[model samples]
Every structure is written in structure tokens, then in C-alpha cells.
Target: MNDRSNARKEQRKKRYQRQMARQQKGSKRYQRTRLNVARIQRYRANCIKNMAHQVSHHLVADSTTMVVALEDLSLKNMTASAKGTVDQPGKQVRQKAGLNRSILQSGWGQLRQYLLYKTFQRGKLLVFVPPHNTSQECSRCGTIDKASRRHQSGFACTACGFTDNADRNAARVIARHAAYGLIRNKQPGQELSTVTLRPIPY
Candidate 1:
């Protein structure tokens, strides 16, 4: 849905840019085209917010779900500019910029906010586990090996050869951490170590 919206926005943006280019800088037509571009941006933001609300509502409305776990993400750090100082330019600047844009567009922060309120209203617990090594750790064997994540989508543990989708494996790791903390009656904000997570049957 976001991809389609982005495509449409791009098409309209190009058309508006062309129209603005043909018009005088301070002309009414140029100002109107500029407003159109702003409107497109606003529409995209509204769509993202709506999607976040829908997703958060669905998760909170699940009867079987008692706790909703999410990564304790730091968007400011994750989306920090990768363009280093002129003396020492950053590597993969373009790639990092694109990643930052995608992260912002995905509305992760917005989704988290929506989930926070919805879960509270629904009387469901919302927990955030540590974000470190969740993807590299094996869900079944509890091994943490960078080599286990051979690709973006696949995870194959080197220690026990446990295999699964990378994202799913990370989710299981997060779930285990949350479950372990709750079972031990750990206080909120107490650290949960990925290394201490127990292996369970897949």
C-alpha cells in the first residue's frame, strides 16, 4: 500500500515540477503547483497514520494476545545522518540515507505510539525488549552467531542448524525475552539478556 502511494506521489510530483518550471516564479500557477506538492506530502503522512492506527488496533483487539512486544528502538539514532565530516566522509552514505527514509516512511514510531494507547485501553501489556542481536540469535537453539544470518530474510543457526525466516526468528527471540522476564517477575525496564534465553522446541 505504501509503495503504491509513493509511486502515485512521485508521478504527481513530477507533473507539478514540470508545471512549476513552465510558470513564472511568483506567478499564481507556480504557487498553486507548490501547494499541490505540499498536499501530496500531507496525504502520504495521513495514509501512514491511518495504517498505523489500523495495525495497532488489530493487534490490541486479538483475544489470544495478552502482551504485545516490540523492540526498544531508537529512531533518532537509527535515522541519524550518515554524511560524516568533510575530513572523513561516511561510507555507504547513499544507502544509509535511503534506509533512513524507508524507516521514517514505515511510521514505526507512529505505530508504537498508537499501540501504546490502544494496548492500554484494551488492558493488554506492551513490552519492549532489547534490540541487540535479536536477528543474529537463533530462536530454537539460543545461539548468537552473526554467520547465522546469511541473508536479510533467512536465518540458519551455525551451532544447531536451526533454520527459519530471519524476521520470524527475531520475533521469537523477542517473545522469549518478554516471556522470560514476565515469568521471573522482573521489574519493568530491567535488562533481559539475549545470551541467557533458553532453547525451546520449535
Candidate 2:
């Protein structure tokens, strides 16, 4: 999927540069190329929107699911430009730019918006939990040890020797937080309590 998208993006860029170089502004050829560019952009956007709708619909349509929990992700902060002023240049600027592109292309904000509206329309609860330390926290033992996250996809609890997929463990942590009402009535950006959370039984 990413490869296809990247190829299409490259094609579009080349087409746009050719149009700019070979066609005069306001001419018929220029207008035609402009419309083609716009069409490609609109098609990509619609594809993303349709995928988001399908995913959100499936989640909301689950019969046993009454509540949906999501991380309150701040995309703006997550994708902020890493380039700094001349006085203090930022490190890993190229890597950060690549990550930012991936994040933006993933359409996370669009998916979240679709989920929000669909949940509301279905009369279900949609809760957003703080995203801090979720991947490092163990869902089985409720241990918050950073060393447990030894790999990108694997998570092993240092305290209880529990092992699970990193993403799944993070999701379980979010579920426990929502189930325990740890952040009820709390404003956005408010810190969760430091009290030890009980392990949720699967």
C-alpha cells in the first residue's frame, strides 16, 4: 500500500513539473494538466476517506462493543518540523521529516474523525485516553518499566515476565484505563494519577 502510494506521488510530481515547464499559464494545455493533477489529488483523498469510513463502521457495528477507546493523539505536535534555527540546528532532521510524511500519509486524523462521528451516531461511548507510556506499561502486571519494551513489535514485562505484541499491550493498557475510569472528568492534557492500576483480567 505504501509503495503504491509513493509511486503515485512520484508520478504526480513529475507530471506537475512537466506541466509547469512545457505549458503556458492559462493555456488549454495548462488547464488540462491542472485538472489532471486535481483529479489525482481528489482520488487519493477519497480513497483515504472511504477506508476510514469502512474501518470506523466495522468498529461501531460490532455487537459486543459498547465503548471505544482511543489515544488522544496530538498530530500537530507529533509531526512538528524538527528543523531548528541557525543558532541551534535540530538533530535527525531527515529522519524526522520522513516520519512526519509517513504519519501524515497514514490519515490518522481522518480515521479518528470518522470514528468520533460514527460512535456518536450509534449512541456508543468514545473515550480518548492519554498516550503516555502505554507501550512500556505491561497489561498483565500493570508494570511501567521502559526496559520491557525491548523491541518495536515485542513487549515483555520485566516484573512479571508477561509477553505480548507491543501494539496489543498498549491497547490493553488503554482499555484498562478506560475501564477503571482513571481519567473521568479530567480535562485534556491533565496527568493521570500515579496510583498503581490493577491488572485487568482477560
Q: What is the TM-score of each candidate against the true structure?
A: 0.81, 0.74
TM value for model 1: 0.81
Looking at candidate 1, the ten consecutive residues that score lowest on lDDT are 193-202
**In candidate 2, residue 96 scores what lDDT?**
81
Give the CA lDDT, 0 to 100, for residue 146 in model 2.
92
Worst 10 residues of 2 by lDDT: 193-202
Q: What is the lDDT of candidate 1?
A: 0.80
Report how far residue 186 has shifted in candidate 1, in Å.
3.4
- Highest-TM-score candidate: 1
Q: Residue by residue across 26-134, what tens digits does model 2's lDDT show?
A: 9988888888777777776776777677777777887667777777778888766566557766887777888776656657788789888988998877877788898
Q: Please list the C-alpha lDDT of all candidates, in the order they appear.
A: 0.80, 0.76
- Identify the candidate with maximal lDDT: 1
